[model samples]
Structures are given as C-alpha cells and as structure tokens.
Target: MWLSRACLRLLIGSDVSEHEEAPLIWLIAGEPSGDLIGARLIEALNQQTGTRFRIAGIGGEAMASAGLKSYFPIADIAVMGLIEVIPKIPRIKRRMRETIAQIREDKPAMVVSIDVPGFCYDVWKGLRGSEIPLIHYVAPTVWAWRPDRAKKFAQELDHLMTLLPFEPPYFERVGLDCAFVGHPVLEGGADKGEGQRFREQYGIPPEDNAICVLPGSRSGELKRLGEVFRQAATTVAEKYPDAVFVFPTVSYLRVQVTELTKNWPGRTVVISSISEKFDAMQACDVAMAASGTVSLELAMARVPHIVAYRMNAFTVQIVKLLHGWNQNFVNLVNILLGREVVPEFIQEKCRGDLIGAYICKLLEDPATCEEQMRSVDSALAMLYPPNGLPSDAAASFVVALLGAQNQTNFDKR
Candidate 1:
C-alpha cells in the first residue's frame, strides 16, 4: 500500500511537470473579427486551466486588450484582396518576413494564425521549414470556390479550426485535421426583443418604415460603396417618403460617411458601437448591407436584407476568375437555400436605383420579408456546435494536440 501511494504521488508530480512544460502559444489574428475570436479564445483558455501560457503576436484592439503584445502594428497588416494588396505588397512582405524571423527567434511551441489568408498563408509558407506546430483559425472558403487550395492548406497546418459546422467534413476528406468551433456570434447570444427598444432609443417613429444601410468598416469599401448606398437610400426615400435611413458607421469611417451623406434628403442617422449596430439592425424593417459578416448578423436578428458590394474592376475580375460564385457575401441562408434568400448585388449590379427598388419591394410586401426570414431561420438551425463555448472547444483541441506533442517529445528525449 505504501509503495502504491508513492507511485501515485510520483505520477501526479510528473503530470504537474508535464503541465508546466506546456509551450507558450503565439497567436496571429490578421483582422478585427479574427482578433475578436482570438481574444475570446485567450480568455476562455485562461479560465479553463491554471496553465501559465504566454501569448504574443500580431492582432487588433481586442487581442491587445486581452494581453497580447503585438510585434507589428495590426493596422499596417490589414490589406485586403489581390489587386488592392499590390500597392502595399512590399511593405506587407517586409512585415511578414520580420514576423517570421521573430517567430524563429522566439521559437514558440505553436502558432495560431487567424483569418486573413492572403497574409497568413504566406506566414505559414515562411514557417513551414521551422517544424513549428500551427493551428489556423477560420479555414478559407476553399470549399465555396477554390477547391484546389484545400490540398495546399492540408500540407501547411497541423490543424484547422473552423467556425461553421459544414467546413470540417470538407477538410477531413482531404486528410486535414479540422474541428468546427461554432459561430462566435451565436456564442455571444442573439439580440432578442431589442428591436423595439432600439427604435425607441434612436427616436425612430414606430409608424415610419426604416432601412438600415451598412456601407462597411474599411475605408476602401466605404469609398467604393458610399455613393451607391446614398443613391439607393435616395431612391428608397423617394418611393416611401416616410422611410428613415440608418447607417451603422464604424469608428474609422464616421467622418467620411457624414461628409458624403450630408446633403441627402432622407432622414439619415449614423450610429457607432456594437449595441448601436444591433439596435439599428433590430429597429430597421429591412437592411441594405455590404457583402461581409454583417449579413450573418442581420440574419441572426431575423431581419430581411439585401447584400450589395462594389470593388475596383480589376479586383472584381480577379475574384470572378478565382471564385465559382459571384456573390458578395457568404450568408448561411444563401448557402443553405442554394438560392439567394437575401438578394446579392455585386460590382456593376450594385446600383442605388436597383437597391432602392429591392428595399421598397421588401418593405412594401410583407410576404417577401417573411419568406426570407424563414430561410434565414432554417440556415441558423444548421449552425449549432456540439458543446461548450466555441472558443473553449477550439482551445481544448489545441491543448490536447500540444499535450500529445509534448508526450512524444518527452518519450524521444
């Protein structure tokens, strides 16, 4: 009995030592949404176990707030698209090279590359020879368009953590380790019954119809879509004189949007912050938004919306060649329904008059809005994860993989 007790103590001590030996995680979140996910994961990991793992790398405000010491300014690395990146390619390449070199010097146990595949893929390629275990968050939409990129992604990362439930099977078929982390927005809870409150708070008249306009957070996006959005609002207002237009202004582009929409005839209101975004989405009868994650948010709010976006002719052409679909946003409803539940107007098609016409129809016809909402609900039903916080599930998977690697190293040593 004494010998058995001693053996148990020794085993427990070894486990403690193994826990202590857990490698510091280096996280790279290339954009705002990715940074938000990274931040939540960091917080969840800290709470899950008393493990003292140090976090460092490139990310935005959310990651910074969660105690990540960003090596490079995240704003500097926030370039998007193929043609758009050409001008800043040299600067991006230099920053990426520096980041890789720093990672080599630091020799982290693992690297977590968040979204922004254009930059993150390059980072992955640079570090491939270093034998560092990498976990990529938010698998790129190879399934949606570039099915060939799956093979390349399989070769690059040790594991791929996905936000959508449908993504794992596609990666798994290609022999890549992937796990669905559920949608972060779902984990954060839906804004229920807040629509009426939102309208009241914003002083939106209950009798008046409302149209929410989401131009986009990026300056380039706003620049390209602003005039079109304003024009669309004008068209809608002309059709429905009692309609109010609410623009959810992201912090950086508030001034620009205000200056651009100054002379608009309709009652235009620009709001900032997350609560305000939800309030605006809830209060509005219909939404005309840029093609991005915001479409998903509107869907979750059960708001009928039209997704519209415009870019430079070169960028549009390049995307057209690469991607099978010409849709601007990846709305779950659109994907599940296999038809546009929320109509998507891209590039040349994304005009003010067309958008105004669409909004007017959605508002005027109750059946159109109802049919779209039903499709959205069906799509939302498909997005559930098995258990726990999405971030927790992702972190747990990483922790388990790290443990296995540590055990293998210990055995070899």
Candidate 2:
C-alpha cells in the first residue's frame, strides 16, 4: 500500500516536489498595506537569491500579482479591532486550523506572517511545534500599547522583521531576534514635483495653497470623522479663501467621503492612486490627517501636518481605563522629539474649529512650516541607516538565517 501510494504521488507530480530547489515561503498578509509590503519583500527575495521561490498563503491582489498563490480568499481575514472581530471568530479559527494542517502536511521552509497580530499570532501558536522557521513582518504595536506581548511574541517567532528603526531596539530589549527594514517609502524617492502635478491634474488651482485631509481608508473611520473633517475644511476655507482642500481618498472610501462632504463649498479633490497620493501630499502646504501610517507617509513627504483620531466611545473609555498614557500614538512621536513638531488633537479636542485654527496658523507662517519640515527631515534621517541599506540589509538577514538553518540540518545528517 505504501509503495503504491508513493508511486501514485510520483506519477501525479505533487505540487510540493516542484519547489524542491528553492524554499517555500508561506506569506500571510492581512491588510492592503501588508499586502503591498509582502509584494516588495517577495520581489526582494527573488532578486537576492537569483532563484524563484514558491510563495503560498493569504494576500490580496497585489501579492497575487507578485506570484503568491492564495490558500483562501485574503479579504476574508482582513478584519480589524476586538469588538469588530467577535462575530467572525469561528470563521477565522477555521481558517487558522486549515493553515496549520497544511503546514504540518506540506512543511514549508518558513512561515512569514505580516501584520494582523490577532490572526497571525493564532496561526503561529497552532504551528508552534513545526520545524518551519517563523518570521513575523511588521512588529505589533507592543512597543506602544502593550509591552508585555513582546515577550510572548519573542517566544513564538524565530525572527521579527520591523519597518521602523525604533522597533528593533524595543523588541531586542524584550529578548526578541529582530531586524529593522527601513521603510519602503524611503526606497521610493520623494519628488516634490509630483505633488504640484497632482494638483494641476485634479483641477486644483496652482495659485491656491491646498491643505490635504486624510480621514482614513476604513468605512468606520470615515463615518466617525467625516463630518468633523468637512466642518474643519469649511472653517479653514473661511480663514483662507485661497485655500483648497484635497483628499487622497482610498478607493474603497471614495463614495463615503463624497456623500459626507457633498454640501461643503470649497473645491475638494479625491485622489486614489499611489502616485496621485504622493503628488497630493507634496502639492499641499499642510495636511490635517488621521493618526495612522499615512501620517508617517506625510512626514516622509516633508509635509507639515496636524494629526487627529476618533474611536468608538466605548473603546476610548476602555483604553483610558486600562492605559494611563495621556497622549495617543499621533503625538507620541512629537513628544519623543521633545517639542511639538506636529500638533495632535484627539477626542473632544479634535473639534473642527480647533483643527481649522491650528492649520490656518501653520499655512500663514512660513517659519512655522519650515520648522516642522526641518523636524521631519531630522526624524527620517534618524530612522534610516547611513547607506540607505534597509531593504538589502533586511533581505540579507532573512536569507542568512535560512542558509544557517539549512547548513545546521546538513551537519546533523
């Protein structure tokens, strides 16, 4: 029976056998941002090795375009927040179990989990005893909100790949093996010209000083802050009649933002593409944005901006109860710099009038805008290594770890 099964497997040409020469890297990315990062890493891995590696797991269209074969629909797992995920727990668990079963049966060389801590951590836990090396891309916000999760993550992952420079030190302090991959944004050049062209393309007057408003990509976020953002823009328009408002809308939320801001009198443009987003950011004199990765992108673009965030009342209250930290993550970076380089407004303080007032101040005062831009330059300089070797350095680290493990196995044989 065993011989017959082996012969049948050989005759059928198993999918696993095709990948015998190169390692099978199982990549799981749970959001659009993570999917983009995973695609870049996939390209880097292929370039570094000069051999085609088989990538299989869950990722969206971007990763699929980069040669990743999905085990299940990636969008199914793209969930957020504790309260939002409760209804989908059973479905998520089923997916996790299926993933673990595949790992055990096929035995991939490495499991690379990117972002989505809640789901990926469960997958890691299920496959804890497997020989497969675990690599987690984009360290969780353990540094900020929950430091204790660091030790648990350290125990599970063989290596943690970080996008931020400050992340490695924090993970290392908790005894995790980690590497800082300079942000992908830096790898893509920052062109101020793109910003100007975007304004022109969007029919925004070149003479007008535009302020970009990015509420967030999520529907819930738009619903929460859309009215406030529109009101803020109206106030700014009143202060500076020449000021135009630009919104680099995520494709998914375009309709929502449009519906919300229909009554506003100011000229507003919503751009969806990556190129357009970069251009919009550059074209704007200042930005009023939600506190998220977009803020980092704006900073990298050298745009002076104000950051704000609004969450469910229940969630905010619970967070306040559990964490005694006075400031949210938006202002935390500025606080680390020892000055208010980027002003932050949150909760009730994130009113339209106040945000509008602050933005008006920044736009009118060239000195203030320059000061903020200087701080952005300083922050980016500190974040990246001297030679701009973040992508190459990170890829080398992952390849070396895999090589070392293979060598150890051969030695044992």
Candidate 3:
C-alpha cells in the first residue's frame, strides 16, 4: 500500500534515457550474509555489464566494498524474530517506505531483493502491478513451513532465484520463473583457508587445540547465545588447558566478544575479517556455533561442529506449532540429507552443559568427527549449480530477465 498501482504506472511510463550506458541495478540486502551474496552478485553483474551498470541500495560492509552506496545502513531493517522485531516495526516500515520512494524515483532496470523476506516482500508489494521486473534471491522457506507462500511469491515476483536444488520446482510449478542458482557457501572460499598460516599468524603451537566460537553476526544473536556459548567453550577449555578459543566476529562485536571472554582460563583470539574467520575454521579442531549458514561453512572446512540457538520463548512456541510434522532438523545439513548429520541443540536444549558435553564427545572421538565431516561432503556437493559458480548463475538469470522484460506486454502497455 506504500505505492499505488496508478503511481507506479506513471513512474514506469516516465522518460528514461535510451543512450545511457550504465543501466542501474538497485539491489537490497538486509543482513551480513545477504550482503556477502549482494557483493558477489555485484561482481558477477560487473563481469556482464562492467562499470556500465550502476549498483545501489541498502547493504553492509561487503556490498559497500563492491561499490554500492546504500540509501541507509542495513541495520535499520536487519532485525529478526517476531518479538524482537515488534519494537522496530515502525522504524523498519519507515525504511521500507524510503526504499519504495527511491525505487519510484530511480526506476532501475530491475530490483533484486536478497534474503530478508519480510522487508523485501513488502517493498515488492508496494510496486505490485508495475512494469518494473521484481526478482528475489534466496526463496522463502515455503517448502518447510508455509507452503502457501510459494503461490504468493509466484504472484508477486517476476522471477525467483533459489539456492537449494529442490526449491525450483515448488515455485516453477506455480508459474514463477524459478532457478536453482547455487549456494553462496560453495564458492565463498571456506574450503580454501590455510590452517597452518592462521596458526603461525596467531602464534599458536601446532599441537594445541584451536576451537572457533561463532555466536552470530546480529546483536540479537549475540545477546541470546553469547553467554551460553561462552559457558560451553569454558567447559571444553577446562578439559584441555592448552585449548585456544578463537572468536570469529564482525568488527563491531569484536570488542564485546573480547570484553566478555577476558576472564576465561585459556588463551583467546578475536578475529574480525572474513579470511581470518575461514582460516580459523581450517585451524579449528571444532566449532560451536549458533545455527544458520555457518554450519555449512564449517562443513566446507571439514570442521567437526555442533549447532546451538536460543530464540524468544514465545517465538519458540509459535515455531514449534508451525513446523511441519516430519520436519526434524534446524541445521541445513541435517535437513538436506533428511537425517541428523550434525547435532543440534535448540530451544530448551540449547544449554551450556548439554552443548559442552557434545563438544567434548566430538573432541574425544576422532572417528565420529571424521564421519560427520564425510556426511557433510555429500550435502555440500548438492549446493553447487550444474553450470557455474552461484553468483554467475544468478547473474545469468537476471540478465535474461532484462531481455524478457523488454518483450513483455506490460512494458508495451
């Protein structure tokens, strides 16, 4: 309701330069992970259009590095969960309006919303019934939770770009032009890290155990899981006095993570850069992380790991009520393989003592660790696009949209 169909039609029909070399691509990414995807997509789009295509929208550090001047900081709308997001609803709505108004003004060739479904879907709805092509990267989890959203996505979006292989059929059957464009974790350089180099740089002894502790990127995640993860890591550290706890965090959270872990018995290293985090993953004997994309990254690094996450109590109950009857896993690796390849401690079970016990088991059992890593290789292999890298495959789909858009009856109208 932010923009009327009448207003959108007027904007789309306005005079646009045919001779302009730089076709504008307004891309929106509402979190760090999506920002990474946005950055790589910018690179791939550059390969297709070079500096001839201008990229702009909301993004974080990574996309900014890829030459995007965002209208606002991604944090303005980066909030997650039902209860946590309620307080920020007004602010997020304001930002969403700002984004819609900008799109109305800029009239970019295509608008691509990456990942954040709530924010992105609203912006797309505002421009609903317009000639402007709407594309969404990372299809919403309709296959797992709300199956009806697949129909909604097909109705609202001009094209759909999915990460999981089995996802395309869900939307494509609904008449949405959905493509399985690979997953970001596959080409993210998670597997290319040099463990020895990381160890040498950090001045850690070769024989010592290095454990990577990732609470999460968002402040909310840190608030929820930080202390629990700290306790779990502490429990593990007690067993191995020489264990080096490596906290791989974003720049803003570096000081907070350091301040929180100052009193720990074992040596601690806080690293902010992505390369350092990946290298730390390689250097790590095991990782205890909040559940999300990091598990896939750990799998890529062949690191033995356990996933833990705690959400608002009310949200937990709602999610449990909403989940499919047979849906058993919170971790992606487990979900894809249709079995528990990695251990997951969620809700009440996401405790320090319980997670620590599992961490201890992984550390003590080398064969178990090897088996989990081997299991993930099959899961990880399925994430790659049949033709090329994830970003490239996504770019090809978008470029095709440009051609199709020109031929559409809506544009001619």
Best by lDDT: 3
lDDT of each: 0.79, 0.75, 0.84
Residues 1-413, candidate 3, lDDT per residue (tens digit)?
12233333333332335754445788999988899999999887666543445777889999999999889999999987778889999999999999998998898888999999989989988987666788899998877787888998888898889999989998999999888999999988889989999999999899998888999887888888888987887788889889998888989888878887887658999999866888988998998998999999899999999998988888767765886433688899999999998999998999998988888898899999999988999999899887778998887677656544544634676
Per-prediction TM-score, please? 0.86, 0.88, 0.85
Better-scoring candidate (TM-score), 2 or 3: 2
lDDT of 3 at 40: 94
What number of backbone clashes does candidate 2 have, counting pairs of residues 3 or more apart or in separate chains? 1
Q: Which ten residues in a row have the lowest lDDT in candidate 2?
A: 1-10
Order of candidate numbers by TM-score, starting with the best: 2, 1, 3
Q: Kindly report which residue stretches of model 1 are placed more than 4 angstroms away from their true locations once superposed.
A: 1-22, 81-87, 188-193, 311-318, 322-330, 347-349
Candidate 2, lDDT over the whole model: 0.75
Taking the tens digit of each residue's C-alpha lDDT, what string does model 1 give over 300-400?
87788998877788865776687665343565568756778889887678898998899889988999999988888877766656766688777767666
Q: Provide the lDDT at 364 for model 3.
A: 92
After TM-score superposition, the amount by which residue 340's alpha carbon in candidate 2 deviates from its true location, in angstroms, is 2.2
Ranked by lDDT from best down, the candidates are 3, 1, 2
List, residue by residue over 1-413, the lDDT tens digit for candidate 2. Answer: 01232332232223324545556778888888788878877776666665345678888888888888888888778878668888988888898889888877768778888888888888889887787899988887665676678888988888998877777877788778888776666665443438766766777777788888888888877877777877888888887777778888877778877777677657777667766778878998889988776776888788889988887778877876785344334553474475667887888777888988888898789899898888877766655643434656556656666666666666696
